[model samples]
Target: MAYPDNLLSRGESVVLSKRPHWKMLVLPIIFFIVIVGGGFTLAAVLRNWEYHTIAWIVIGVLGLLLLIWLVVVPFLRWRTEHFVITNYHVFFRSGILHRREHQIPLGHIQNMETSVSFWGRLLGFGTLIVESAADQPLEFENVASLPKVQSVLNQLIMDDKQAHRGGPQQGGYPTGPTPAQG
Candidate 1:
């Protein structure tokens, strides 16, 4: 999904936007299938019973509840969570009803690393840990293409620092006139 441009500052542009990897939904999908399949099976088994209709109703209600709690909620959380990289900052936003957003300026980021387990490496997703100035490291889990993300973030941070120091920048223009030139 596209990150909302309205949240960006003027002149800022999005570099990357992604949600958690599809692996995050595996359990939810499994639960969904089980709930649907079990509900149908139970309904079929009760078809000849005296209270079959009532049993089916109960099964339907219980299945719906289980699906909503185990599948729908997780799906919504995964859908709403966003990991975005911009020219100026990195953003993480999550929550369904009440939103929570956190941003770290590229210039403020001091360190970054990627952690990939054997399964993660085989699946092409891992965690990205971002450490900003004087702040706790923020871990973005199940990031797809983690190595690429880390590489891009490193480049952005370098470029941000260069621009702020009035040095050579990505677009071959200094951010502003240096005091020495003025």
Candidate 2:
């Protein structure tokens, strides 16, 4: 999806962009299954005729909390987190109540590497490690559409390099003395 042009400065263009891989939803799915299974197990275990009311209430409350986490938490995370890339930088934003954002400039980027697990490969997703000349490496973990993101980043880097190499426009402009005069 295209972000507003006003979001970045002049000469900036989006290079690589993606969301978290669908695989990330797995944990929440497992949590949901566990909650259901546990609820059933609790029901069976508490089938005794003399069960305490307090114990039953506690089990119900725990199950409700689990249900909220499984159903609501994952959905909120999926909706809130976003990974964005521009010609000059990469941006990561996430969180619901307390928002967080991080930006890494392309000029500082030393190299980028991608890793994919068997399941991730099957699903066409991977993790991207962005190394910088400075301390601390930035990681884009479990990112979907990795190959396309990589390709765009590579192309942007090449373009930036070529632009740098072309060197001092308008035919040098003879700063000291002309060769013809010498």
Worst 10 residues of 2 by lDDT: 167-176
> Which regions of candidate 2 fall more than 4 Å away from where they truly are?
1-7, 10-16, 37-57, 166-182
Superposing all C-alpha atoms, what RMSD in Å does each candidate have to the true structure?
Answer: 4.6, 6.4
Candidate that scores best on lDDT = 1
- What lDDT would each prediction earn against the true structure? 0.92, 0.77
Instruction: Summarize candidate 1's per-residue lDDT along 61-109 as a digit string, tens digits.
Output: 9999999999999999999999999999999999999999989999888
TM-scores of the models, in the order given:
0.90, 0.70
Candidate 1 off by > 4 Å: 169-182
Model 2, span 10-96: residue lDDT tens = 988776556688777878888888887888788778878386466677788898898887867887787678888898877887787
Cα shift from native, residue 106, model 2 (Å): 2.0
